[model samples]
Target: MQEVSATASLWKVALSLLVIIAFIPASLWLLKRFQLAQMKLGKTDIKILSVQSLGTKEKLMLVEVENEKVLLGVTSHTITHLKSFPKRGRPFDSELVQAQHEQVRQSQGDDK
Candidate 1:
């Protein structure tokens, strides 16, 4: 009887550990599926346009707030405004494409 009780208790402990291990992955999957990791605070005017990583702990972010676009330098402890651009009539994508074309033309001219 004593041996049987000990075996049952061991089985119960093993089952509990297995359940806890399974729960971690299950909860992670649910959070990723619903994108619950990022908190949403209703609707806001500020939008992140792009992010470029500078180092392990630093990044540059382009953000649009209200009518103006801002370039920000982000570090582990601080966020600094690097520059700001005036609101333009056209979309950012068009401006980016134009800049890319200009760069290509400059490179071609240099090679020639």
Candidate 2:
């Protein structure tokens, strides 16, 4: 009787340990699956189109919410809206493009 009780107690401990070991991986898998589901279902609003780094802890983000595109400044502690771009079908920076082309032409002329 004494030997049987000890064997039963040992089996209980082994089963408990096995359950705990199995639960860790199972819970991690469930958490990852839940996050993925949230991402897939939460895609309707607010999509980030681009991000540019300004400094170590600051960034500029161009995001589209609904139909409007807005530029935002992001930092460690705050997010600020810098500007809202015009509606679709208009150029963003025609002069900037022209200036860049002129610079390239000047550089090529200098090289020649």
Candidate 3:
């Protein structure tokens, strides 16, 4: 009787852990799907195009609002608009991004 109860308790623990592990990713996928649908419906005017973390709790975010682009400073407690500018030609330029990546790689190579 004692051996049977111990085996049953171990199985219960394993099942509980498996359920928790599965639940986390399932919930995340559902949330992402809902958010994407909302974006497709055009419910919001603002979008975050990119983010660079400045520190553990601070970041610089490039956001798009209507036809304008804005750079923002974000921290754990506050958000500040750093700059705003008119939209140039495209929302995102692939060539510009590629050039920036190349420059970063070259700089890292120089450091090493």
- The global C-alpha lDDT for each of the candidates, from Candidate 1 onward, is 0.92, 0.93, 0.93
Show the colliding residue pairs in model 1. Answer: none
The total number of steric clashes, by the backbone 3 Å criterion, in model 2 comes to 0
Per-residue CA lDDT of model 1 for 19-98, tens digit only, reads 99999999999988676445453467898999999999999999999978999999999999999999878887998999
lDDT of 2 by residue, 6-76 (tens): 99999999999999999999999999999989988986778889999999999999999876899999999
Runs of candidate 1 exceeding 4 Å displacement: 1-7, 27-38, 92-112
Cα lDDT for residue 59, model 2? 100
- Cα RMSD, model 1: 4.8
Leading candidate by TM-score: 1
Runs in model 3 with CA error above 4 Å?
Answer: 1-21, 90-112
Report the Cα lDDT for candidate 2: 0.93
Candidates' RMSD to native: 4.8, 6.0, 8.6
lDDT of 1: 0.92
